[model samples]
Target: MAFDERALVRGPQPAVPEIVPYDDGWPDRFEQHRRRIAVALGSRAHEVEHIGSTSVPGLGAKDVVDVLVVLDDPDDEAAYLTDLERAGYELRVREPGHRALRETSGRRVNVHCYAAGDDEITKYRLLREHLRAHEDARRTYEDAKRALAGREWPDMNHYAEAKGPTIHRLLREAGWTGAL
Candidate 1:
């Protein structure tokens, strides 16, 4: 199903762009969220991976931990959303093949929910792993992010969209030939 890009804007927009130095505790924070998500979903959580800038060491980010959770049936929101809500994760974005939840307190987290074998999931993991293994690519990405962060954006989505070219270039260098 083709998703409306506008639907991705379900969350509150940041008033200003904010990018900070890499936090050494990002991995620990991710692990904490991972554990919480695991317990919330139990056996339904097939895979949970830390992605995005925070996942890359020394990469400056918005201090938000991005996590990807692959499930056997992501569309079955009732199976997991309720539990996650009970655990304090507010459902922010809900699309045909994806769902995103944000933690209301403590360290920030974005839990992306996707169906098993979704290409989007694969792309995220591949990009994350590639960045981890290639320092030059990681540096380039950080530079691009830093430059973009200096600009004003109407929302987080706009900021994310502004990073598209650099991201796509990195993905191509990392062996992605599929359409963006």
Candidate 2:
């Protein structure tokens, strides 16, 4: 019989590690995760995109690739959940705000799956794009994240929440008039 290494690992899994800032390997890391998700979801995914600090060069980040797998039919999310589960991602949480934010966790990956046409993707893209083009915004965002990482909230959500001020401030400066 073949040995299943993952099954042999015991105990409740550890929490995702603290943010590690920018690393040169971030893009390749995202590519590997993207391929895995793409193979698993096949046609169900309209697109899997990199949309976070890791996607922007020279920006320090949490060392995790934030990917958005956009599905065409919002009502059919339940169907894809099973496939995602099979792909080694454990469902983390579903955003109460729009129901479009579904977080998943893997050994080294944190994925936020959203429905196509959802504003979540748009906001992420806009923020990421704006930050990439604007040096001041990138530096400010990086400094804010590092400061929050030092505090080290109980989990990722709190960390994200703590960074909201910087995010909002940048968005405002970028002329993002809130989620369109």
Tens-digit per-residue lDDT, 22-117, candidate 2: 788888888987898899889988898888888988898776677778776544557676777787776555543222232245345567766776
lDDT of model 1, residue 106: 56
Give the runs in model 2 whose Cα sits over 4 Å from its true position.
1-17, 73-77, 96-106
Task: Note the residue pairs that clash in candidate 1.
Answer: none
List the global CA lDDT of all models: 0.83, 0.70
Give residue 168's error in model 2 in angstroms. Answer: 0.8
The residue-by-residue lDDT of candidate 1 on 32-70, one tens digit each, is: 989998988888898888999899987788989999998
Using lDDT, give the best candidate's number.
1
Q: Which runs in model 1 stand beyond 4 Å of their true positions? A: 1-5, 8-12
Candidate 1 C-alpha error for residue 6, in Å: 3.7
What local lDDT does model 2 show for residue 155? 52
